[model samples]
Target: MDSQMNAPWSNCSIGYSCVKLFPPPMHTVPHSGEAQHRTSPGVEGRGRMKRGVQHRSNGRSARKTRPGSESGFEVAHDFGPAAESARHFDPARRGYTWGMIRFTLLSFLLAALLLAALTGCSRMRFVVDLVPADDGLTETVVHEDDDARWRSPKVALIDVTGLIADVRRPGLLTRGVNPVAEYVESLRRAEDDSRVKAIIVRINSPGGTVTASDVVYRETVRFRERSGKPVVVLMGDVAASGGYYLACAADRIVAHPTTVTGSIGVIMQTFNFSEGMRRIGIHADAIVSGEKKAAGSPFEPMEPEHRALLQNMVNEFYDNFITTVTTNRTGLSDEQINTITDGRVVTGRQAHELGLIDEVGDLYTAFDTAKELAGLPAARLVKYHRALQHVGSAYAESPTGSSSTQLNLMQLNLDGAAMHDQPNFFYLWDPTIFSAVR
Candidate 1:
């Protein structure tokens, strides 16, 4: 057969295409909910619906409703026979309910134990965490040890770390617990509650605003005078400045042997960054309403007279601190007090020798001291640790938050480790006490 005869005819038809393509037929169908606006028949005025504007019904009720929005009978009648199987005992839904049932049963079992607790099962003790707040934020950490015997419910461990404005400090203030106010209230509660035999204030602070310190100080003083409750103070790492101020409220203060205590002064610090700014050609144009208004501004050089005035203010606060301490620890000579308390960091032993602290011991010893001071029967030790809550501050702002968790002796968090560290106030160190030592 010839090649052309065997091949299809279309293969040789170069001028024409083999298959023909056609376009789809065009059509339009009416869609739901789209009604174009036009002038209503016979009505010339307000009857004409406006275009390019949303048509809202001014009628008292809805003119139309969607399937999902259908009301009354539609909701009841919509479900078919399929709903009958899924009503209650559907196998698909049983697992979740079964889990809930298990959880409820477990919870019920635990409830009896809690009921046992309510019925005076074990001597219930509350651990009141009173970590000082930083930047007005409290950082209180609670701990439970394996040796339950060491835990004391009667003893309230109030943390008075920084700025004793509230019961919440150094870390817990962020959660909104005020240590000072809490102290006053707790002391009152302890005084009234026959169950709370004694109170121990765990002082681990560098002090803060004088007003804040005074607020807590006044409470402690009131607690001692009015209640006559044995208020034993256990000094943490550094109970200097305002911390010591509050410790003065206690009948006896027991600090660790190496605990740094006794700043015994007030201080305020201001930074001068003008020189650094001038080096970078940065200038400050400050406008103020008063002459002394810009006194604390670091942009300008402080006037000599202004500096003298500020120093006088510091001196007054220092005098107040000295007077307060003298009233608490009477008979100590100026030289001796200055040597011990003159913004200097000293060991608990040194503080004891200097008559700053009454003894050197932990919270356990403080508890015993509290009983001794209270003159009560067999000092029952109780630990008060508050339940953890939404503490807002970060670790940087509140070091105690993280440090407090690790109560390990050798390897602990910074804040926990700080509990045994040295004195803390850099602003108050002066030539009188530290200069000779340096």
Candidate 2:
């Protein structure tokens, strides 16, 4: 009997049932004539121990008897409550809930509606591509009356604002447009348009380099001769010195009642730091071929000859300014011109009384004058700009499109390195450095 109970078990027959079985502990030995049954702790036996059958904890019927069960019996194992809960769980139901399904359906519906709404809409070209090419400037209509006919005769509006220079003005992070080039280009554009009968040059500047101002003045005169179009000047807050020089090219000049004009002179500014350097125990020496080679240098004192030489140059440029004014302003007498040309600035009303400007009225007055000169009963006002430039109306700010900031301290612009890098002659109106003696 001991040998039979210790033997390996065989596969169950066709009529029998089978389950995994474990041998009892060595300490438990069963008597030969009786059958033995074992259970886990905390579980109680529900029925008598039979020789060839085993009971399950779930209360199922007893398994069929095995072929060798008379010698040994099978064991039925139960996992606890965890296995019981897993038996009835559904994985598919947990992953796709009702709320998640509704959200997904709503998203699909919204996308379909949006697509339907956009189906028949006309496609707009990207504005980036509408930018003008390098060869030409963009023309925009800033003002048009309700009754104005389309493509009627136009009066081009050109702006000359801020410091006028031929080279690009340096800014914080980038370089600005060359004022001279921009002015010339706008004139060319206006000249080519046959519909543009005339141009209104709006000037708001305190003057700039002498050569730059002269170049613009010459170009404005050339534009009028070639195009046969009348040019009118509209002065803004300040049009003095170089600004006045350019205004001389216009056929007629108009200024606002409060505009400041007429600073007809030239200036060359310099500083001497030799005294401060001497106090700091610093001395500078220079070897020159001539005594005047280093004239007007900041490191040295101004010699008597140096002073005389600079004064002579200032006088020559001043003479040129006086000539330009007298030739354009034929209404002014020689004595009156001499009086105001002493580097004095005057208001628009005062300038009109002195025969410096033609009229003392607002912008519309200038427009009406332009229309009468161009021989047009009704015309549209247009402005020229580059791509990405905003010129919504004739009164758009900074028409020169210069991004350079003029940081002034004691009436000196800090960003004006172009003026200070070397000794330059200017037709400028700077109160700190210049004063008029009546």
Candidate achieving the largest lDDT = 2
Once fitted onto the true fold, the runs of candidate 1 whose alpha carbons sit more than 4 angstroms away are 1-155, 162-176, 388-438
Candidate 2, superposed: residue stretches over 4 Å from native: 1-136, 399-411, 432-438
Q: Tell me the tens digit of each residue's lDDT in model 1 across 244-357.
A: 887887878899997877777765455578888999999998898978877756678888877777778778878878878888887798789769656777889998989888
What local lDDT does model 1 show for residue 151?
29
The C-alpha local distance difference test score for the whole of candidate 1 amounts to: 0.55
User: Across residues 1-438, which tens digit of lDDT does each residue of candidate 2 receive?
Assistant: 221122112111211111223322211213242645453344444233444444343354334433555644433333334344545765557666866898899997776666556643232222333543463478788886566789789999888987777776653223456788889989998999899999999998888889999999999999999999999999998899999999999999999989988889998877788999999999998899998999889889999999999999999999999889989889788789878899999999999989988998877788889999988888898887765566667787653543224444444453354665767889887564432211
lDDT of 2 at 312: 98
Return the lDDT, model 2, position 104.
97
The C-alpha lDDT values of all candidates are 0.55, 0.74
